[model samples]
Target: MKINNKDEYIIIVGCGRLGSHLASLLSKERKSVVVIDNNEKSFNRLSKNFSGFTIEADAIEEETLLKAKIDKADVIVTTTNDDNTNVMVAQIAKSIYKVPKVIARLFDPSRQEIYEELDIDTICPTILSAIEFKNIIIEAGGED
Candidate 1:
């Protein structure tokens, strides 16, 4: 099938909480989305209104990405639980598949540098939560 570039094509690897939420949100925005996960049960986390495709396959496998049409993806997000898995998938999407926008969920803030060096964008929840906590403390006039 020919993918239309007019619509944003997003490929999400790992249908965990974050991945599923993103898929559902993007689907609601009417973006073309395909979610991939090894465990078929994980796909159930997606919202009932999610209008997207789900693929049950290990994202580490090249065949799985090929099936997802990685070459045609405009954006790819890797939200796997394992940091290594997320990095690997992001690298493949950016370096190999040449997807324009590649983002990976990183649990460790220290690894952000490595991802930056690889030219892959990362969203670190741990770091973000810490920043939010700091902001709240400051707003409360807590001691430094």
Candidate 2:
């Protein structure tokens, strides 16, 4: 889902490297964002310019999602390093909260089909990196 609208409300699960970066970027674009993470220190990864709210909590709990206002969120993004956590939160956002757009970062390409079946969009860094590396090798005329 293309989140081109800056006015959209966004809820992000996890405040790790990827989550913090996304929250910061969306904040810069003037989107209303709420980032949730179990570790409060993780929020530190967010840029100094970030204007969004940060919540320290486990996203797996329904109460946490509720406090993040997931019900009215236009987009919910799961970027935790753990594949299970990401998919679980993404599924909740899509199936329970009925968020219009749900995006997740998946490390294991093998589990991608599960997300696809749930109709939740996933960004698999491992697969993407492999594809990029393959393209670069092909461009260099392949290895002998």
Query: Best by lDDT, which number?
Result: 1
TM-score for all models, in order of appearance: 0.92, 0.93
Weakest 10 consecutive residues, lDDT, candidate 1?
1-10
Per TM-score, the best of the predicted structures is 2
For residues 52-80, write the lDDT of model 2, one tens digit per residue: 99999999999999999889999999998
Local distance difference test scores for all models: 0.90, 0.90
| Error of model 1, residue 80, in angstroms | 0.7
lDDT of 1 by residue, 29-134 (tens): 8999999999999989999999989999999999999999999999888999999999999998898889988888899888899889988888899888999999
Question: lDDT at 94 for candidate 2?
Answer: 90
Give candidate 1's root-mean-square deviation (CA, Å): 4.3
Instruction: Show where candidate 1 strays beyond 4 Å.
Output: 1-7, 142-144
